[model samples]
Target: MRVSIKDIALKCNLSVSTVSRALNGDYGVKSATRTSVMKVAKELGYVPNIAAKELVSQKSKLIGIILNESDGDGEARPAFFELLPHINKTLAIFNYRAIIYTINSNSYIRGEITDIINLRNLSGCIVVSVFRENHPIYEDIKSLNNPIVVLESSILTRICSNINTDEVMGGYMATRYLIDNGHKQIGFVNGPQNFEISNERFEGFQKAIEESQLQISDTAIIWSNYTGSGGKDSIHQLIQNNPAITAVFFANDLMAMGAISSMAESGILVPKDISIIGYDGLFVCKYYNPPLASVVIDNAAIGVRAAELLLELINGGSGKTVRVMPKLFEGKSVRKY
Candidate 1:
């Protein structure tokens, strides 16, 4: 048989109201009474009724982890996976639980997110990997009274906080690294335009080129999906259009690896024929043939920080933005020109 607060109260010979107040840690309850109620509750094997507590408190203890549906099929960025454990661990510190919700990237509409929040009675959400600026979901999230924290793309509200790496600086660092090695004829392979990070990185790339007085032909820059296959195709297109380019900077590690493999199939050697640098600083980069140079974002730090910010919002804190700095990881992929 299960034990209830009433059983504990009966065993302690206290009023039900006093027992409840002690169990809930309410102010004005005497410390001695609280300790006595806790001891009796433990002796009786009393368990908390979270659902009932939630009803009375008017807030759930559930935290939603929202991801794009494409992430399941390996079409989205891998950084989110790295972020998950940290977020989960941080939430556990506050006795909160996390639930993941994957929504279709192209098909999800307004009110769908709100519907999910209502159905689950979630206290807060951490949205990851959806980068489109004017999407219907963004509008819905903006109007929601519940707290939300977004990763990467910006969508600020009174209840929403945004967190991202300084992508422009990351892009600049990648480009500047290549330029410092005496490679002037460089190409850039970026992700699709709908993502704000893509544009920010591109801006950094352009800044490096202009400052160095180097010229990049229109044909040397290609915007493609952030996938391995997309990387392979972009490499072929880039090489075909600008055969004189001595180096390339990929916006992500997957594409850089894909391009490397594709180049090998065509009897072209990396660093020997062309140098490369990538972003995201994935773990696999260290093990790849010739290794890969990349701009590293501290995924674990970002995850922990995002979780902390969201919990603050849940507790009636004001919304704010946070941008983490990126560091460069050098590898054998970039050959000095």
Candidate 2:
């Protein structure tokens, strides 16, 4: 019951080849003829078959991806869950399909990326792994002919496009907010060691603390993996080291949530006993018993922009290094100190 290009051509009384070329916006089709073909195509409700088009074009029309898949049934991070849809939706706009290549952190091996990419015939690739420094795939990634876009904080390789926020600025903003809030004993809960985002954010935190001349104890800064268990486990060590700390800036929202929950379980109330501000503005933050204040980056925007950059690279363009800024969202968790 669907209308076809042949139907449009028949109605317009034009050759099938001429109708096809005009519909595709190919050269050699007259403007008047192209317009007529479109008018007829629209009238007939003719939809271009993407699958058929791709077959003829001899391109996969599929965007390849590498995402971290947990080995166990542990909960996924909020960032990955939210980011997947935005990437798919953005790719849909360009009539492209997304093909996920999930990998466990331990399973990533050298030359594996190249093998899969070539086998899939991917038009381009996006690496969504939340990485630590010197990601293992660096060399193999460089050897691929396909374009790559990484969500890493640094330009780890020459061939890939990297997109990340100014984590240092984010850290600065959070710390300065605490200082301006009349809280002198501000604490910081950092992410795992060697994470570029975590290090940058910590650097910014240090800058603000030094500028404010605020006293910081070794116990006040906690190093945590960007996970709930990590956050929960880290807080006791921190509080035992610096019992007088008032406000804490968490590197990511997930850890913040865990810290707050752990604090509550230990009979401490948020903002009353301590104030917490988290990075990564997840939607679930709003529903927290007391909404969590956070630094919100445009993760959705980052995904789309990375896709755009990769597509450009696929079309013979060079990758450019870019950084996006984040904004602070004031939620109910932070009290006026």
Candidate 3:
């Protein structure tokens, strides 16, 4: 005994097609007729079948959130997790629901994105994944007709928009903080060089170093994966290679925490012996034994902007790029001279 549009149509003494058009607010239906149909629908307790409605309208109010599987340790996507609630909240305002689609980097290389979008009838998408510049996924995305918002990556398609943190400024802020605090012999621990973020951060670090009339040794910089364990090894190597180094900037907070634990194990105290700073302003940074200073990326802001940009594209706006600035969070991990 389920209520349907047919029940409302019969009660309103109107044809099914007229009732359907009235319910959807389609043109050619008078305002009074639409109101009467809705009132009759309410009286009959008519419930809509979403799939049937979508099939008739040919527009699914579904948004896709595409994520690339993490490279290692499965904890690399903390920022994406943080963005989920904000993105969903914003999309809900427009009566759209978000559907998550997880795929490997190789899937993009194999060009599986089209199938995923078409199969779900997604009206738009926000991609929260990282891929190298030469990856075939960039070309695959360009050929797509749907609105796409890419986070932490760039694609030069008319239908695609890019959003990311001001990475160069973030790198400069972290390194400059150390230099201003009387630490000249500084070291930098970065993520894999293949990542654009890693290279941009390196550029920022170099900008600060050169501006201060300082020269960094060849061994002062180390590139590693964005993992806690990678941090432990990088800090150990940095200390051994440059005993004169008094401070270091880690590309992410997880690595900074790992480096802290390794230093604790080796009886090398923080701040008293060396200072440390990090990027990505993770929540755990403020609660560590010695709070860690960091450059924070606002994931919530990025999420809202991404959703708005997708809507703009759906409404016929051209694709554009947006960059969120980073904020510096001071903690006890850095000591002033």
Return the top candidate by TM-score: 1
Runs in model 2 deviating more than 4 A are 1-57, 71-73, 156-159
What lDDT would each prediction earn against the true structure? 0.88, 0.80, 0.86
Best prediction by lDDT: 1
Cα lDDT over the full model 3: 0.86
lDDT of 3 by residue, 234-298 (tens): 99999999999999999998888889999999998888889999999877778987999999999
Model 1 weakest 10-residue run by lDDT: 69-78
Can you rank all candidates by lDDT, best first?
1, 3, 2
Scored against the true structure, residue 9 in model 1 reaches a CA lDDT of: 83
Superposition error at 58 for model 3 (Å): 2.6
lDDT preference between candidates 1 and 2, better one? 1
Q: Residues 186-210, candidate 1: write the lDDT tens digits.
A: 9999988877889999999999999
lDDT at residue 131 of model 3 (Cα atoms):
70
Clashes of each: 0, 0, 0
Query: What is residue 14's positional error in candidate 1, in angstroms?
Result: 20
lDDT of 1 at 39: 91
Question: What tens digits encode model 2's per-residue C-alpha lDDT throughout 1-337?
Answer: 9998889889999999999877765434577998898998988889998678768966686888787675222657777667778888766655567888886666678787787787877878898876667666666676667788988556644457888888889999888887777888878889876778889999989999999888898778888888887777777777877788888899988888988999999999997988888898898888986899888888888888887777667656777888899999888888877
